[model samples]
Target chain A: AQSVAQPEDQVNVAEGNPLTVKCTYSVSGNPYLFWYVQYPNRGLQFLLKYITGDNLVKGSYGFEAEFNKSQTSFHLKKPSALVSDSALYFCAGGTHTDKLIFGTGTRLQVFP
Target chain B: AAGVIQSPRHLIKEKRETATLKCYPIPRHDTVYWYQQGPGQDPQFLISFYEKMQSDKGSIPDRFSAQQFSDYHSELNMSSLELGDSALYFCASSLVQGANTIYFGEGSWLTVV
Candidate 1:
C-alpha cells in the first residue's frame, strides 16, 4: 500500500514572498511523486512529477519541488508568490500495483 | 492537445434514484480512473480500468459500478443514491495503468437530495 500526507491544511503567504507546501509519502517499492493544483470549481491540473533523476523538479507556473530521498519528503516550493497562485494543492504518488494515492490537500492563500 | 471529456457536468437526483456518469479518455490512452471528491475533501480513488477490463479497485461502494467500453469510454453507474453520494466525480486517463501522468477531466458534480 502507498499513501501521501500533507500535514498542513492551509498555508498563507504574502505576494512576492517565498512559500512552501510540504508533502511526505510512503511506498512499498520505488515511488512516483506528483503535485497537482485545483482551482475553484475545477478538477486537478498536473503541476510536476518526480520519477527519478534529479532531486529538484521544476513545474508549471514557476513552481518547483524537491525530492528528498533520505527524509522521504517532496515539498513544493515557489521563490516568489502571486495572488493568483491561491488554490488547493494535492500531493499524489505511489507504486505500480498500488496506483496513486492523494494527500488530504493544502489550501494555499496567497495575499496580494 | 485533446483532453478527457466528461458528460453531465452537473447532475441532480433524488434519494434512491440512479445516475450514470460518462467519461471519454484521451485518444490512444488505454486506462481510465474514477475518483470521488466530497466538499473540502481530497479525491478518493474509486476504480480503474485498463483495456476495457477492470484493473484495480479502491474504496468504491457496492452501490457503484463502472465499466470501460471498446472505444475506451467509461461509465459509472450509481444506485440507491443517498445524500452522502453528492460529490465531484473526476475521471482521469493515462497511456497505461501506471503512466507517469494521468490527465483528469473537468469533473461531474452530483447532487443527491
Candidate 2:
C-alpha cells in the first residue's frame, strides 16, 4: 500500500536558522510528492511538488523541498525560519491528478 | 487569481440530522474533490468528480454523498450525522488536464452535537 511518513511529530528551530522537516514515502510506479502547510483552523496551503526532473524544487513562501528518489524522501526546508512560519506541515504522495496519501504531519515551531 | 470557494463556513447540527456543504471550483477547473479532516488530523479524501461524473472515491462513509452540478460547483450531502462526523469538510479543484495541482477552499467547519 502507498503510504507517507513524517517521523518527527514536531520540529523546533530558532528564528533565522535553517529548518528541515523530514518525509518519506512508499509507492509504486512514478512518484509525485507534495508539501502542504496549515495554520490553526485554516485550510491547507500548497507549498511545492515533485513529479520529475530536478531533485530540488522551490515553492511559495520561501520554502523548498528536496526529492531524494533513492532515499524515498522529500524533505521540506527553509533557509531561514520565521516565527510566522510555524505551522503543521504535511507530506503527500500520489499520481498526478489523483487522491493523495498524506503523512501524519509534523508541527514546526520556530522560536524567536 | 480566483481560488476554490466554499459556502456556510461554519455549521452546527444535531445527531442524525443532515447538513449540506457547497463548493465552487475555480473557473475552468474540471475536477472537484471532497475531503474530511478531524481535529488535528490530516485530510482524508472522500470523493472526486470529473466533468460531473464520479472519478474516484476514498474513505467516504455511507452517510455521505456528493455531486457536481452543470455549473461545475459541487455539494456534499451528509446524512445521519454522528459526533464523529463533526469535522472540517474541504472542497478542492484542479484543471486535471493541465496544472493538475489541486487548490483548496477555506472549508466548512461542521460541529455535530
Candidate 3:
C-alpha cells in the first residue's frame, strides 16, 4: 500500500524566514509524490510534484520540495515565508494503481 | 481554460435525507475524482471515474455512491446523510491514468443537520 506521513501538526515561522513542512512516504512501487495547499473554504491547490527527476523540485508561490529516496521523504520548503502563505499543506503518494494516498496534513502558520 | 466545476456550493440536509452533488470536468479531461475533507484533516479519496466507467472506490461507506456521465460530468449521491457526513466535497479532473496532476473545483460544503 502507498501512504504518506506528515510528522508535524503545525509549523510556525516568521514572515521572510525559511519554512519547512516535513513529509515521508511508503510505497510498493516507484513513488509519485505531490504537495498541495488549502486555504479556508477553498479546494486544495497543487504546489508541485516529483514524478522522476532531480532531487529538488520547484513549485508555485516560491515553494519547492526535496525528494530524498533514501529517507523516503519529500519536505516542502520556501526560501522566504509570507503571511499570506499560511495554509494547510498536504503530502500525497501515488501508487501504480492510480490511487493517491494523502498524509494527515500540516498547518503552516506564517506569523508577521 | 475552464477548470473543474461543481454545483451547489453549499448544502444543508437533515438526517436520513439524500444529497446529490454534481461536477463537470474540463473539456478534454478523461478522468474525474471525488474527495471528502473534514475539518483539519487531509482530503480523502471517495471515488474516481475514467472513460465513463467506475475505476476506483476508496474507504467511503456504501451509502455513498457516484456516477460519471459521458466522461464530461459526474455526480456523487449520498443515500442517508448523517452528522458525520458533514464535510467539504471536492471534484477534480485529470488527463491521463496514473500519477498525473489533477485540476480541482472550488468544492461543495455539506452540512448534515
Question: What is the clash count for each candidate, in the order shown?
Answer: 0, 0, 0
For B1-113, candidate 1 gives per-residue lDDT tens digits of 99999989999999999999999999998889999999999999999998899999999999999999999999999999999999999999987645548889999999999
Best by DockQ: 2
Q: How many pairs in model 2 have backbone atoms within 3 A of each other, for residues 3 or more apart or on separate chains, i.e. clashes?
A: 0
lDDT of each: 0.93, 0.93, 0.90
Interface RMSD in angstroms for candidate 3: 1.6
lDDT of 3 by residue, B9-88 (tens): 99999999999999999888888899999877788999998888998989778999999987569999997899999999
Ranking by TM-score: 2, 1, 3
lDDT of 2 at B84: 98
**Candidate 3 off by > 4 Å:** B97-99
Candidate 3, position B2, lDDT: 86
Estimate, for each residue in A1-112, the C-alpha lDDT of model 1 and write its tens digit: 6789999999999999999999999976788899999999998999998887899999999999999988899999999999999999999987653457999999999998
**RMSD of candidates 1 onward, in order:** 1.2, 0.9, 1.5
Q: DockQ for all models, in order? A: 0.70, 0.75, 0.67
TM-scores, all candidates, are 0.97, 0.98, 0.95
Predicted chain A of model 2: TM-score relative to the true chain A?
0.98
